[model samples]
Target: MFLIFPVLSYGNNITLDEMLNMIDIKNFDKKIYDLEIEKNLSKEKFYNLDSYNGVKGEADIKYDYDKDKYDTNGKLTYGDFYVNISKNKISNDIDNGDSEIICGINKNLKNIIYSKSDSELKKLDYLKMKDKFYYLDKLESKKIDLINLYEEYKNNEFETKLKSNNLSKLKTEEKILKKSYELGAIPKIDLQTLQVSRENLEIELKILDKNLKKIKDRFLYEFNIDISNKTLADIQVKQIDISKYIPNIGERYLQSLDLDRKITIENINYLSYSNKVPDISLGIERKKETHNNTNSENRIFLKVSKDLFYYDVNLENEKINLAQQNINYRKENEKNISNQLKIQENYNNFYRNYIINKNKANLESNKYEIMKKKYTLGNITYVEVMDVFEDYLKFEVEAEKAKNLFNGYIYEIMVRGEKNHE
Candidate 1:
C-alpha cells in the first residue's frame, strides 16, 4: 500500500474500527429506500399545494356606510335570503380547486415507475441484481477458499490440453521436414513456419493467463471483506418463483402491483361528483343621494350560477371511460403476463435442468482435467487435448448462465403476492 503522507507525521483522528464501522450495511439497500422516501416527499409537496397557494383567499371591502342607514335594523336583503355584508369587511379562505390532489397521485406513479422494483421488465433485472449480491456474498464467505485457490494456482503446475496438441503438431512438422529434406519435397524456409506456430501458441497461453488474472481480480475486489479471507464452498443454486410475478398479472388494479389504485378509485369518485350541482348566490344593493344629487334608488338582487356538462358530456365522458378502459387494458395485460408466467412455471422443470446443466458443466471440466493430465504425459493425441480444453471453457461459461436463469425464477416469487393480492 502506498501512503499519501509517508514523509510527514500525522496524528490519528479516527480509530480504524470506528472508520470501518461507519460504513453501514443499510447502504446496500439504500437505492430502493431512497426512492420510497422521495416518493413520499413528493406527496407531501403535492398535499401542501393548497396551503402553498394561501388558502384560496376571498374578501369583500366597503368604504363608507353609516351604521343606522346601512343595517340599523339588521334585516336581510330584499330579494335575497343570504346575509348582505354591505359596508362591512368580509373575507374567507377556501379550497378553489387548485389543491393538486391529483398531482400527488400522478407523482406517486411517476416515482414508482422510476424505482427499480417497479420496472415493467423487473423480473430479469431483479435476478441479475440478486446475482451481483449473491456473487459478492459467496466470495465474502469463501475468502479463505479463494486465497487457497490462488495459492494453489501459484505453486501447482498450470496444465492445459493445448500443450499436448502443440507437441503433436511439433512432432508432425518435424517428421514432414525430415521427409522433405530427404526427398527435396520443400525448402528449409518451411521449417520456420512450424517453429513460429509453436512460438505463437506459447505466447497465447501467457496472454490468456493475464486475462484470467484480470477476471479474477474483478470478482475478488467485489467479494472481498476487510476481516479475513475464508473461501466458502458448496453454493446451492437458487431458484426463482416465476409463478408469483406472473400470477401477479391477474390484478393490475391491485395495491401490490400498483400503489395508487385506491387513490385512483377515490379520484374517479371525486371527479364524478364535479358535475353534480351548481352554487347559487344572492345580493342586495341600495343607493342614496343628497338633495343636491336627487332621489336615491334601492335595489335587491339575486344571482345563481350553474355549470352544465352539455358539450363535455360528449368530450369528457371519454375521460371516465378512459379510466375504465385503462382498468380493462391493464387487466388484459395481467392475463397475458399470467399466461406467460404459467409457461415459465412449466419451465420450472428447466430450472432443474439448468441445475443439471450446471453440474454437467462441472463434470465436463473435470473430464477435461483428466484428459489434460493424460495428454501432458503424452498418453493422448494433441487434437484430443485441444478439444478438452475448449470444452472446459465453454462449460464453465454455460454453468454460470444456468445459475442466473434459476435466480430469475426465484425473483418472480418474491414480487408476486398472495390471494386477493392484486
Candidate 2:
C-alpha cells in the first residue's frame, strides 16, 4: 500500500474490508463468470507481449549531425557507419528514419492490440471484463426481482387459492339458476349466463398456472442455471441474512485496480525500450585545407561519433502525453461509474421500503376466500367480489416484484459499485 500510494493521487490504497464494503453482488452465473475468466486470459496475453517490445533493437544509420564537417567527395571511403540502437523514447527530428523504424517495429510487435477482430469469433467470445461483470450484475438484479416476485407469490398464494375458490361460488350460482328454472322463477337464459361465468373462473385459474410456469422458466434461463438443477434431497429452506453476504465492495475495486496496473505496466514497456543502441560507430574523415590544398595537401582524421540521446525527447514527450491521456480517460470512466453507483443507492432504499411494505401488507389476506364463500352462500353479488379477487392477485405479484428490486439494489451497491472503489 505504501509503495503504490506515491504513484496515484488520494493514495488509492485499499484492503479486503474496504473492497468488501464497496461491492454489492447477490448472485454469480456460470457463463458470465467463465467469460470473465476468458477476458482476463486475453488481457494477460496482451500484456505478455510487452516483454518483446521492451527488448527490441533498432537499426540506426549514423551520419554527421553537423553535415558540413564531413567533406567526403565521390571517392571510395569507409567514412559512414550504421549501428542498431534500442531507442526507448520519442524523437524530436521529424525526418529521423531510425526513430520511424523503431516506431514501426514496435507497432508491428504490438499489432495484435489493433488487429482485425474476427467478427464471428469475437461475437462468440468477444466478452470484455467490464461487460461480463456488468452482465452478471444485471442478471443478479433481475434474479432478485423474480425471487421477490416469487416471495410475494408464495406469501400470497393462500389468497390466490382463496380467490380460485370463486369457482365453488360459481358452481353454487349455477345450481341456484337451475333450481330457479325448475321452479319457473327465472328463464333458462340466466342458467346459460351462470354456467359461462363458472367456466370463465376455470379459464382464469389455468391462465395463472401458465403465468407462474413462465416466470419459473424465466428465472432459470437468466441465471444460466436450471432452477430444476437442484439437489435430489428435499432440502429445508434456510433463511439467509443478506447483509452478511453483501460482499466487500473494496475488494472488487482492488481486483480491478490490479488488472489495470498490469495493463499499465505492459503499455509502458514500448516506451521503456525505445532508446536502445548497439555498440558504437567509428568513421574516418578527410580535412582538406583550401589554402592551395586541393592541389597537393590532404589531412586524414579519424572520427568516432555516438548518438547521445538516441530517442528524441520531444517525440517521446508527445507519446508520453498520449499514453497519459489514455490512462486519464480510463480513470475518468471509473469515476463516472462510481458516481452512478452513488445515485443508485438512494433509489434502492426508496423502492425497498415501499415494495417490501406492500408485500407484508398483502401476505395475510383471506378476504378473497371469505368473499368467495359469501358469494356462494348468496350473501354477496358478483360485482361486489370482483375487486376483492383482483386485489389479492395484484398485490401478490407486486410484493414479489418489490422484494426482487430490493435485492437488486443491494447487489448493485456491493458488486457494481466495487468496480470504481477498487
Candidate 3:
C-alpha cells in the first residue's frame, strides 16, 4: 500500500503519517490481530500435513512358558498405506523347535476422500486472515482521522487566540475614541461603531471558545490523548489518482462464493461417502504355526463394514441450502461495498474541491494587508479596513476547517483501499 504523507513543519517536526504509523504499532487491537493471524497460519500448516489425523502403529508380543510358545505382531500405517508382520514359534517334548513367519500389506482407500476438503478449508482460513488484516488497517486509518480532527481543533484555538488579542486592541481603541468624542475631537457615531464591533467580537470569541472546548473534549474521548499542549502539523493537499488501486468487488465476491462452494462440495462428498460407501480394507495375510507338524498358509482378504442407519438426507439438504444462502449473502454484500466505495469517492471529490476553494479564499484574504495600508494612506474608510479584517479572519478559520475535511477524506479513501486524488 502506497501512502502519501505531505510534509509540514511543527513542534518536534513529526509528520502526521509518521505519527499515525507509530501509534498503530502500539495499538492493542493490531497486536491481537497479528497474533491471531500467526495462530491461524500455524493451524493451516498443521492441517496441510499428511499426518494431521495421526500416525498409526501397533505391536503385540505373547509368551506361554508351559507350551514354550512365542508370538509377536507389529503394524504401521501412514495415510492410505499399512504394513503388518507376525511371527510364532513352538517347542515340543522332543526338544525340537520350529518357527514360521508371516508378513502382509494393507491399504485404506476411503481416508483420502477427506483430504481435499481439509486443504480447502485451511485455505479459507488464510483468506479470513487477510480480511482481518484489512480491517485492522482501516482502524488505523480512522485513528489518523482523529488526529487530523485534533489538528483542526488546534487551528480553532489559534484563531480564538487571535480574536482575543484583537478584542483587547479594540477595547483600547474604544476607550480612546470615547475620550475623543467627549472632547469633541471625534464624531460620537465613530465611538458607537467601535463599541458595537467590540461587542460582536466578544460574542464571536465566546462561541469559538465553546466550540474549541467541545472539540477538545471529543478528541480526548476518542483518542484518550490530551491535546492541551500538543502541536498539530499542517496539512498539504496533493493530487493523486487512485482508480488503479481500487480492487474489483466482483472478484472479492467470487472468492467468498468459492469458499462456500468448496465447503459445500466437501460436505456433499462426506455425505455421499458416509451414506453410499462402506469402509473397506484390502490386505494380504500370511500365517505359520509350528507344532506336531509344520504348517503354513497364505491368503489375500478384503473386509467391508457399513452403518445402515447413518445417512441423514435432510441434514445434508439443509447444509446445502445454508451454503447457497451464504453465497447469496456474499453477492449482496459485494454490491453494498461497491456502492459505499462510490459514495466515498464522491465525498473525496467534494473535499478536493473544498480545499481548492479554500486555498483561493486564503489568497484573496492576503489583500487584507493592502487594505490596511490603504487605510493608513486615507484611501479607504476605517469601516472598510475593519470589513477586510473580518473577511480575512473568516476565510482563515474556514480554511482550517476545509483542511480538516480534506484530510478526513484522504483517510477514508485509504481505509477503503483506494487512493485519494484531487
Candidate 4:
C-alpha cells in the first residue's frame, strides 16, 4: 500500500508515514511473525515424502536329531539289495539343520491417503498465515494508538507555551494594578483578583509541563526514540473525494478464513472415509532355504489391517457437525465485522468536525486581531484584549484537536488498506 505525504524537510523530523515504514524494520513482533511463517513453509515441504519406512530382512534356523533317523535313514525295504551301499553311513549322521532367509518391503496404502489429505490442510494453513502477513489490519490499529499519543504530546506542549506567555502578560498587568490600588485609583479587590488569576495560570502551566514530560517519556519507551530531540512533522490532511474512497473489507483475509474452514471440514470427511479403508500394505518377498537340498521362493503378498475396537462412527459424525458449525459462525462473524467498520461514515464525521472547528478558529482569530488594534488605540483596556486573546487561543487549541482527529482517521484508514483517492 502507498501513502502520499507532504514534501516537508525530514532532516531531523519524522512523519507518521515514516514511522509506519519503520515498523517492518524495527518491530520485534513482526520479525517473529516472519520467522513463524518461514517455519511453517518448511514444514509444508516435509509432508511430500512418498514412503515412511524402509526394507526389512528376516532369518530362521532350526537344528534337531531323532533316534529313529539315526538308526534307519537311507534304504527302502524292497530295493535294499540294489541300493544298500550307503545305509550304514546314513545312519551314522547325527545332526539335521535347515535355514531360511527372507527379504521384503511394504507400505500402508491407507496411511498414504491420509498423509496426502493432511498435507493439503497444512498447505492451506501456510497460505492463511501468508495472507495475515500482508493484510495486517492490526498494524493499523497500533498506528492509531501512536498517533493519539503523539498528538496529545503536541497539544500539551502548545498549551505550555500559551500559558507561559499569558502568565508573563498577567504579571505586568498585576504590577500596574498594584500601583493603581496603592494610589487609591483602583479597588483592592481588583488587584487581588488579578493575583489569583496569575497564580492559577502558574499552576496550570506546571501541570501541562508534567503531562508533556510523561508523554515524551512514554514515546521514548514505546518507540525507542527520544521525542524531545526529534521533530514531529505535522500530519497533512488530503483532500479526498469521499465517493471514490473504498474501505478495504479485507477480502483476502476473509477468503482465507473460509478456505481454512472448508479444509477442516474436508479433513474430517477424509478421516471418516479413511477409517473404513482398512490399513492395506503390498510387498514382494524373496526367500532362500538350505538343507540337504537348497530351495528358493518369491512371492507377492497383500496385508490388510483394521482397528477392531478403536473406530467410533458416532465420534466421526460429531466432528463433522462441529466443523460445519464453525463455518456457519465464520459467516456470521464476517457480517458483524462489516457492520462495525463504518469506514465512510467515520471519515465523513471527522472531516466535518475538522472543517467546523477550523472555521471557528479563523473567526476568533479575526476578532482577536481587531481587539489588539482596539487596545493599541486606547479604545479597549489591556485586560479586555487579553480576554479576547484567551478566547481565540481556546478555539485555536480546539481546532488543533479536531485536526488531529481528522489526520488520525485518515492514517488509520490508510493502514486499514485504503489508498488515498484525492
Candidate 5:
C-alpha cells in the first residue's frame, strides 16, 4: 500500500544531516573572509611603521678653481657626504664646497604616540573579519534552501503520479460515458465535459513533469548527487525555549559595530593628546673642511617644533562629537537586534503550527484511502470519492509546503539565533 509519507527502499538515498556535512570548505564563503582578515593583518604591520621613515642620504663634491692664482693656487675641494635619518632633506653647497654635513637622526614624537590608536583600529578590524559566524550563518541558510527545494521536488513527484492515476481513471469513465450516450442513456455533453477535464489535467501534468526535471537537475548540480531515486528524511523540529534564547551580540554585526565604537574611542583619545606632543628630533652634525687642511668636527643638537596653525584645528570638537555619534550607532543596532529577535519568535510559532498540519494531513490521507476502497466496491459514487480525494490532496500539498517552512525556520534559528545550536 502506498502511503502519503513512507520510507522508500531506493537504491540511493541521503539524509539532510549527511548532505549538510558534505559542505566543501573550499567552496565556502568563509575562505573569502579569511583572505580579508589576512589583508587587515598586513595593514596592522603598516601601522607599526607609520611613525618612522628611512634614512635620507646626501653627498656633494666640487673643484675650487681660483682664477686669480690660476698658475699655482688652483685646488680640488671634496664636499661632505652625510645620511639624514629623517624625512626632510638638507641641501649641499655645490658652488663653494664649504657645506656642513648634518648627519642626524630625528623622530616625530607625536607620530609614535598616534600610531598606537592606528594599530588598535587595525587590530579591531582584523578581529571583526576573523569572526566566522557571519559566513557560517549564510552557509546554513543556503543549506536550508536546498533542503526545501529537494522537499518540494519530492512532493511534486508524488503529485504527478497521483494525477496520472486520476487521468487513467477518467479515461475509463469517458469510455463508459461514450457508450452510455450512444445508448441514449447519457447526454453527449456529459462525455464532452469529461474529455475537456481530461485535456486540462494532461496540460497540468505536463507542466508538473517539466518542473520535476528542472528541480532534479538543479539538485544534482548543487550537491553532485542524483536524487531521482532518493527521498529526504523528515525534518526534525527542535523545541526551543524563547526565554533562554539570548542572542549573541558578539558574533556578527553587533560585534563589528562594537569594534567600530572601540576604534572611534581610540581615535578620540589620540586626538586629545595630538596637540600636546610636538615634533621633536634629536641628531648629530659632522662637518668636514678642506680649505687648507682637512678637519672634522661633530656636535649634538635637539630640535623642537609645533604647528603654529594646526591643520586639524577642529580636532577637539570632533573628539567630543564622535563619542556621541558612536553611542547613537550602538543604540540603533541594539534596537535592530531586538526587532530581529521578535521576528525569530514569529518564525518559531510558524514551525509549531506546521507540526499540527502534518498530523492533520496524515489523518486525512487515511480517510481518503478508505473512501477510494468504498468507490471500488460500488458502495460510493465516483463524484463522492473524488471530493474526498480533493480534500486529501489539499491537505497533502499543504503539509508538504509546511514541511519546507518547518525545516527552514528550525535551521535559521539554530544557526543564526541567540543560541549557538550547531
Candidate 6:
C-alpha cells in the first residue's frame, strides 16, 4: 500500500495560478476584449468633457500703414456663449488707444440634453465592462481548477501502475507455487491459498486499470496532453473556511443589472430629446475707435432656432417601454443568480465532507504500515497481510480522489463572481 517510486522532476511543472496567468497572456480573445474596454474608456472620457458640443475661439490683428491705424480683436465661443474684446489705436498727431470687452451666455437645449444622455450611456458602458472582466477572470480560474484535477488524476494513475506491477509479480509467484506443489515441494493447500490471493489481486488491478483509463481520457480531452510519460508534481491541499470564501453571486448579478438598467434609461433619454428641443445662443460685443475722437459701442445679441421636421413622440414612448422591459429582464436574471448561489453552497458542503474523508483515509494508511511491520516479524500469515494491504490501498485511492474534489471546490468558490482571488 505504501509503495515508493523514484522522484522525477520536469521543467514544465507549474503551479495552478501560474498556468492561469500563462493562459490569460496567450488568449487572443481576452486581448481583444481588453482592447474594446480601452476603446470604451476613451469614449467615456470624451463624453465626460463639459464642452462636447464643440467649441472654438479666434483672434485677429490688423495693421493699416496708410491710415496709420492698428486694430486687435479676440472672440471665444462655446455651446451658446460668446465673449468679444477689441482695441483700436491711431498714430498720427494724437497717440490714442481705446479698448472694450464684453461677455454673454446662452444654451442649446437639444444638444445639451443629448450630450448629457450620451455621457451617461458611456458611463454605463464602462460599468458593464466590469462584469465582462470579472467573467473572464472566473473562466481563467476554472481552467486552473481543471489543470489541478488533471494533476491529481495523474497521481492516481501512477499509483495504479505500481499496483498493476505488484499484481503481476504476485501472479508469477502463484504460478511457481503451483509448479512446486505438482512436484511435491509444497502442499496443495498452499498452492490454493496463493491462487486465491492472485485472484483478488487480479480483480483489484482490473478496477484500477479502468479508473486510470477514465481519467486519462478526460485529461486528454480537456487539456490535449497525453500524460502517459508525464510526471506531475503533487498538488497541495489546504483546509479553509468555506463560509468566509463563498462568492456573493446575488450582489454581482445586481451590479451588472444596474448597469444594464442605466444604459436603457440613457437610451430612452436620447430618444426623447433628439432634435426636439431648440438651439439658443446669447452674445455681447463692444467696439472702440480712436481716430479724431475716442468712441465705443456695446451690443447684446440673442438667437433661437429649432429643427422644422424632427419630432418622434411615438418612437420616444416606445423606447421608454423598452427600458421598462429591460428592467424586468434584469430582475429575472438576478433571481436566477440567487438560485445558482444556493446550488454552489450545497457543493461547498459536499467538498467539506470530502476533506474529512481524506483525513480518515490518511489515518487508515498509517495504521496499515504498522500492520505490515508485524507481518514482517512472522506474526501474521501471508493471506492476512494481503487483506490488510488491500484495505490500505482502497483507502489510499479514496484519499487521492477526495483531495482532488476538495481542491476543485476551493477554486470554484474562490472565482465564482468573486471580486478578489484567494
What do the candidate models score in CA lDDT, each in turn?
0.43, 0.46, 0.64, 0.64, 0.61, 0.63
My TM-score estimates for the predictions, one after another, are 0.41, 0.42, 0.60, 0.72, 0.70, 0.55
What's the residue-level lDDT of 134 in candidate 6?
64
Clash count list over all predictions: 18, 37, 0, 0, 1, 0
Which of candidates 2 and 5 reaches a greater lDDT? 5
Q: In candidate 6, what are the lDDT values of residues 86-183, reduced to their tens digit? A: 87887763655777666666555556546664656565564655648565655655476566666566556656765677678778777776777789
Better of 1 and 6 by TM-score: 6
At residue 214, what lDDT does model 6 achieve?
A: 80
Which window of ten consecutive residues has the lowest lDDT sum in model 6?
1-10
Compare the candidates by TM-score and give the number of the best one. 4
Between candidates 1 and 4, the one scoring higher on TM-score is 4
Off by over 4 Å in 6: 1-13, 38-109, 120-124, 127-131, 134-138, 141-152, 158-162, 168-176, 179-231, 279-348, 352-395, 420-422
lDDT of 5 by residue, 308-391 (tens): 666674666667667776887778777867776775677767777688778988998898889768855767655565567667
The local lDDT score (0 to 100) that residue 82 gets in candidate 4 is 12
Give the poorly placed runs of model 2, Cα more than 4 Å off: 1-200, 211-258, 269-273, 276-380, 404-422
lDDT of candidate 1 over 1-422, digit per residue (tens): 11311121114332222212332232233344446556555554544342233322233433334421211112232211223222322123232211100000011222222332222223333333343344333323343333333323322113323444555666676686667657975455555544555565576667656654554453334322221222222223334444555555334333322333333443444444444434433334444433333444556555555577445453365466657766866886767677766756656765776778779888987897798588557686545655665566556556655554454334323333323211
RMSD of 5: 8.6
Clashes of 2: 37
Encode model 2's per-residue lDDT on 1-422: one tens digit a residue.
Answer: 22322221112332222222322232345445666778667765555443342332333333365542222222221113222222222244443221111011112222233322222223223335445545645554554454444443343344346447767866877787688779986566657655666676688777766765665465444322233332211111224433443344334433444444444444344334333422232333233323222322333333333456565665466566656766766776677567556545665575667566675546525776787688678786655555575566566656555554454455445443333322
Residue runs of model 3 more than 4 Å from their true location after superposition: 1-11, 45-107, 116-144, 147-151, 154-158, 161-165, 168-172, 181-230, 246-277, 283-301, 306-341, 344-395, 418-422
- Which has the higher lDDT value, candidate number 1 or candidate number 4? 4
User: Which pairs of residues collide in candidate 3?
Assistant: none
Candidate 2 worst ten-residue window by lDDT: 98-107
